[model samples]
Target: MRSRSRTYSLTFSIYSLILFNSLALHASEYLISYRYVVKDSALYNESLSISQAMKKCSGSPQIALELQTDGNKNLKKIISQNSEKFTEYIHKLGMHVEYKDTTNKAMNKSTTIMTLQTTCFTVDFNDNFAKIAPLK
Candidate 1:
């Protein structure tokens, strides 16, 4: 009876490991990087100037807000609901935004990395955004 119980326990552990491995294999990582570029050289210079002034006054660099999600459907929902609002806000700053989406099939879970890139200044609030700092 003891031998039978040990066999059962081993079988259960093997099954659990297989299930976890399968789930991990099916998971994906998603990255949606948004590049915010000033429409023209004049606007780029103005943005740089404003960023410098703000940083001087606040004693900290400006930081752009970021959105994060765990699944494609949720990300789509968020963008659909807020695209216009985001566009208008960025437009007001004399900039245009572009998005680049990438997926990694080897990851163990769903994840999204969103980044905002600009020119001539830096405003980073997270590690992911730090990867694409503005050009100096």
Candidate 2:
């Protein structure tokens, strides 16, 4: 009886460990968000032009636009094929890359482990605060 109980306890412990590990693995998907402010209207326009060009070149209008990176196999495939061009576009954006924590609870929870590479970009402007409005 003692040996049978010990074996059962060991099996349960192993199963629990496996379940926990699986959960941790699934939690590894990260949603990285990029935010930048273009202070100059000319620069912002230029950035928009470059962004449109990037979309044309990549044949993916979603490129440089707001994208949901997690589980986006199509976007992943596009970026993998045009990594150099994508890097160039980001570089041409001419904004300093700054890492900041997301205040969103869902985003924070999803990114707890961060094993997968996911990214998002958002260009936000406050008309009342900014001297120039974004070009339509």
Local distance difference test, each candidate: 0.38, 0.36
Q: Candidate 2's residue-wise lDDT over 1-136, tens digit each?
A: 9999999999999999998876554332222322333332121212121121111111112333232233443433444455566545555544454333454756441112111122323222232221111111
**Residue range with the least summed lDDT across 10 consecutive positions in model 2:** 49-58
The global Cα lDDT (0 to 1) of model 1 is 0.38
Best by lDDT: 1
RMSD of every candidate to native, in Å, equals: 19.0, 20.0
Clashes of 2: 0
The segments of candidate 2 whose C-alpha lies over 4 angstroms from its true place after superposition are 42-136
Which pairs in model 1 have colliding backbones? none
- Model 1, runs deviating above 4 Å: 29-66, 69-73, 81-136
Tell me the tens digit of each residue's lDDT in model 1 across 1-136.
9999999999999999998875543231222334433332222212111122121111222334353323333433544455665445444445443433434685332222222433332332233222112222
